[model samples]
Target: MEILLNLKNRICSLGIPLHAAFEDIGTDKTVELWSEIFLNCGQIMKEQRLDAGSAWKKVISENRGLLPLEQADWDSINDFGELLGKSDRLNQESVLDMARESIALLEKKAEEAMKTKGKLYRNLGALCGAAVVIVLI
Candidate 1:
């Protein structure tokens, strides 16, 4: 469960840089930036070790610039990753458009997750954790 959450965060985290690179670095330059981003992602996974989620949050916070990633923006990121893996269109506009859509979707999701009703889910997590400990004992 935590792995999924962290992966969601990482995927959203990746879109932040990719979106910025598309806008700031321009289409012609993003290939290099994409490679660099992948490298940074691998390093994030490696360096975080046992505390990956928090460490990744910090790493992303430090590098995410002004683009705030919310809880709602997280769900579609795994789907986006799947599409990216199968996609063969490496052209500038194609990749840029995909990145743009991902950014928008993720941002929207984050906003939704912060809404009033979503607070209930926090207790559910605690319940699940307590169940696990009970099972262990």
Candidate 2:
């Protein structure tokens, strides 16, 4: 989410290309995969003379098994690629903003689910430990 936000801001304010924006955002150390994805997409777009959308698709396809995203996140990412570099600057920014929003919502949902499931697992572990203690006694 931070990367997406930073990319959008950079593209909108600095008018940087998608690949450049991604490269800048990829410098962050929070997630290694994001850096790899950004660098790979940049290389694909530059070397192959492909558009941002096509380059993004290629990168995603190659890294599909390694990505830890949910279905909604994947959909948002693919959708963002479809609009990227296919329209005017304003439209590109709008697409980025929309993708950021979609990812933000997905993050919220994931956080909520984590909280709920974390409690459940903690309780389950406690119960199992109690059962084991009783059996030993």
Local distance difference test scores for all models: 0.43, 0.79
How does each model score on TM-score? 0.28, 0.81
lDDT of each residue in 1-137, candidate 2, tens digit only = 77776777777777888777666666666778878888888777778888888888888878878977777678767756777767777887788788888878888988998999999999999999999999999
- Please give, for residues 34-84, the per-residue lDDT of candidate 1 as tens digits: 334334544544454423334334444455443344444433332333333
Report the Cα RMSD per candidate: 14.6, 2.3
In terms of TM-score, the best-performing candidate is 2
Evaluate model 2: give its TM-score. 0.81
TM-score for candidate 1, residues paired by index? 0.28
Task: Look at candidate 2 and give me any clashing residue pairs.
Answer: none
Angstrom error of the Cα, residue 75, model 2: value is 3.1
Alpha-carbon error at 57 in model 2, in Å?
1.9
lDDT of 1 at 96: 37
Candidate 1 Cα outliers beyond 4 Å, as residue runs:
1-37, 41-90, 118-137
